[model samples]
Target chain A: MRGPYTLVHAEDNWQTDMGAWFSGERVVFRGKDLFTELNDFSWFKLLMFGITGKEFDDNQIKLFEAIWVLSTSYPEPRIWNNRVASLTGTARSTCVLATSAATAISEANIYGSQAELDAMYFLIQAKQAIDEGIELKSFVINHLKTFRRIGGFGRPIINHDERIAPLLNKAEELGLANGQYLKLALDVEKILLKERFRQILNVAGLAAALMADQKITLNEYHHYSVLAFSIGNISCYIDSSAQKEGRFFPLGCERLDYIGQEKRDW
Target chain B: MTKEKECITTNIWHEEAEADNPFAAKAAYCSGYDVYGELLGKVSWAEYIYLLFKLEKPQPWQSSLLESVAVAIANPGPRDLSVRAAMNGGVGGSTAASCLMAALAPGAGKNGGAREVYQVMRLWQQCGFELSQWQQHLANYQDEQAVEVWPASEHPPGFDPYGASCTTPVLQTLDHLTSLCPEEGALAYLSEHRQQLEKAADCPLAMTGVIAAAFTDLQMTEDQAEILFLLLRLPGAAAHALEQKKLGWRNYPFFGDGLTLTNDPGPAPKEDNLQGAL
Candidate 1:
């Protein structure tokens, strides 16, 4: 798909990483089904794309379902045991933040926030408008004008993002979404713009909105959102770990002071 | 492939002074003769195939062929469509297995499953904790301290179906891999967001964060981690079973008293062997 050079690479990177993971012995267990693994990997692959600022695809949603089934294979004892351990670190903390963001934003979408829960309302409205095959651009423009009087890819981080449009494009072709869906997302973006922090219509919100617009069902959206966010978090964690290591030496501290004794004469 | 040939004089190679384990048996066969001295070498996959069918050491290629078929036989049933497609499409069994293991989360959120260890590790890393810190934190919550025990209780608030406790041998290997990861940008990203990560708690994002941390700690190239997770758990388990003689190859049943049980299943795929698989 065309639009945004970054999304293409993000998608490719995700697929390549996922393919490599899929081909490795690490993911495979002897007494299990192969498809479940592929499906799980695909879901995480899309999630990684979202992390890198790409859009979600419906095929990714199917993969999410497949992941759920595979995930269910473990016994309760094992699940709880593993999860408790997983929940203890900085990783768990970040997951909390990401989920909290999602929960808060979704709540704002459903309920009006002082700044702009209206954009979420608009998203639902836009979904209805698009369902009737209305001109999405007009509806979005009206909302954008009313929300913040901004338009197009010149506004904020959303516009600056390297991967947005292509994700929307792929979503459109998968029969899972359309351009108008993004317009509604733009509406949300405009609302986020009104916030103190220049919030962008993140991949999560847009994905949730798109899935919602396609009438994918709330439960499904919840499921996909959790899985996608979790998968995205995997990439985020990797990024974070790298960051942690790098911080051991600040920019100016590249070389240590030669304070210790000089070498003795040979 | 099923029936066993009764008797044959084949040269056996014994690398070990004594056959104590599966690897020792394999070494013995590879070394060219047993203590009693018998010819054990075969030249081709076909010849080795005949030998294995006759309960002898098949040549390496023949072993590979048999392993491939055995892998095929071990794949999930056709009812699991995605797995069938993956296997048919030529994805290796070990890789597929790890992904499946990670993906094996329950919908109801009420039972135990593969705890997303890689994901958990990833999150821990993201949040600014060292692997040791994360492992310590996880250990505090676990009921058991065994090397391979499950890390938490069942029905964790947000569970990863692919996790075991932090004590897995793979964790050590992951440390090795982490030291080798090439990308520096990802590291910068983590540092930039460490505070934000550290502040999160008990949410879905946190769960993802933890899983991601594990992945990062493992220095898992996504595919490599996926494959390793899959094969590591089950293969290790299988190897243990074989060593315990809970399962046996050929007519030497686990419960049988008179069987020779001389056949070796070879080395279980350890981290190095798994890396080779990659």
Candidate 2:
């Protein structure tokens, strides 16, 4: 509803494609009963339905959930995002804030949602280019030259991504491994392996290809994946909250490599 | 074990370890300036914030300019989506971090939030004071689609496409910020040629535009502007959230009849057939 605006677009009522609460009567979710009809649907399934306005099979839902359950739940507070959660907990801060800060940090460029989204877009575009008869090798090189970094590649600190094999095994187990995007991804890996040994298919690359194969639009993927790191992050928050204050890997002051202006008189 | 962690870090923060406890900070410094010993109580928040980003103390005018922009962004009120999100967290008995995260989630949007300011700051980097370049850039904005990660701005980054007019606050901010800058500064250019910029973009000037120009005048990196925009505006969200926490959700401006929910499981708003519903 329009709160304070004189613009023409300001309307009296806002429309939602999703279902609504009938006060004390019942709840609706995408034309289905939140209680009666879809009560048995898993949370991930419900979340996906709400995000994309479409129902997914249990197998698909399981695969999606497994991606988070297996891979994202690092539980290590040293990860930048999780570190915030740990700090919040150690500070005796609330879980909500810890999760919030952690999630916010998860929006980091290199290893977060933006990277995944960028990689997904690049994969989509790269696929189209492949279809258009652009040589995959040249397209890959040109993309590297233009973007400075390829979206789906680059797993820092480690030469290989440990997550890819498990993800592939899981996908194969679910019979969802046969995707063209995944194929394209492996083909790109072929080039990277030959040319740049260190650059390998990261989880972002694999996940992007899999989601692309699932035909999950960028917007849909974004909404569904916002809570991607919540499990591990929230765990750190709660666990550290129970520990001695500020004791989650407490750091000595000597660790800071301050490279700013030297201390001076005011 | 559910999960497990570690770390020490920062360029902007340093601590001299007490002789007894190395883990405990005996003295804190922000950008090599002593925090408690020197800068605190002496330096205004605007000056300190400026120092934090620019890594140097700002001149009086620069500090004043920064303060003016910070004041403008400090409280966007409840109607602003970010503040509303914060209020929701406050009223709902949510954690302060959650509340701030809620605010930041929307505040990071490309529409009228920090991201908008960031893009405009970048536009400033690209166009500077050349109205012709701005006009040309807005006209040929599609060129940004090439290597840029964020969505290529379809409209000019700073101006609000939905705003009907250049609002009073935006105009006032432009006026005030212009007063703080040199005659040849970015704010000065914006103040002088806002109409031309507006006509080129076909939208009214917004606070974001003013902040972008002022940030440009302050010589802040676009990345810094983006984060600072979110941070400076948090005071309002946080204050409102605290206020709303006291007032409770009942008084927290619910849009009754404003939300028309579709696909009701029980029945439509007009109909009342309830067979399989809970």
lDDT of 2 by residue, A62-175 (tens): 788877876677898889999999999999878877887788678667888888887788888888898999999899888888767888788767777788889889988998
Q: What DockQ do you compute for every candidate structure?
A: 0.01, 0.51
lDDT (10s digit) by residue, model 1, range A135-192: 7666655665665532222323234543345556666556556545555676656644
Query: Which is the leading candidate under DockQ?
Result: 2
State the displacement of the C-alpha of residue B220, model 1, in Å, after optimal TM-score superposition: 47
Give lDDT tens digits, candidate 1, residues B1-278: 88743332333222322244422222234222232233334244434433423334444433443344223223323223223323222223233323233223221111211244343433344334354453344433342322111233432222322333222322343333223333342333333343343323221122223223334433444343333334423433333223323222342222233222132222334568767798
How accurate locally is residue A257 in candidate 2, as Cα lDDT from 0 to 100?
72
lDDT: worst 10-residue window of model 1 chain A = A107-116
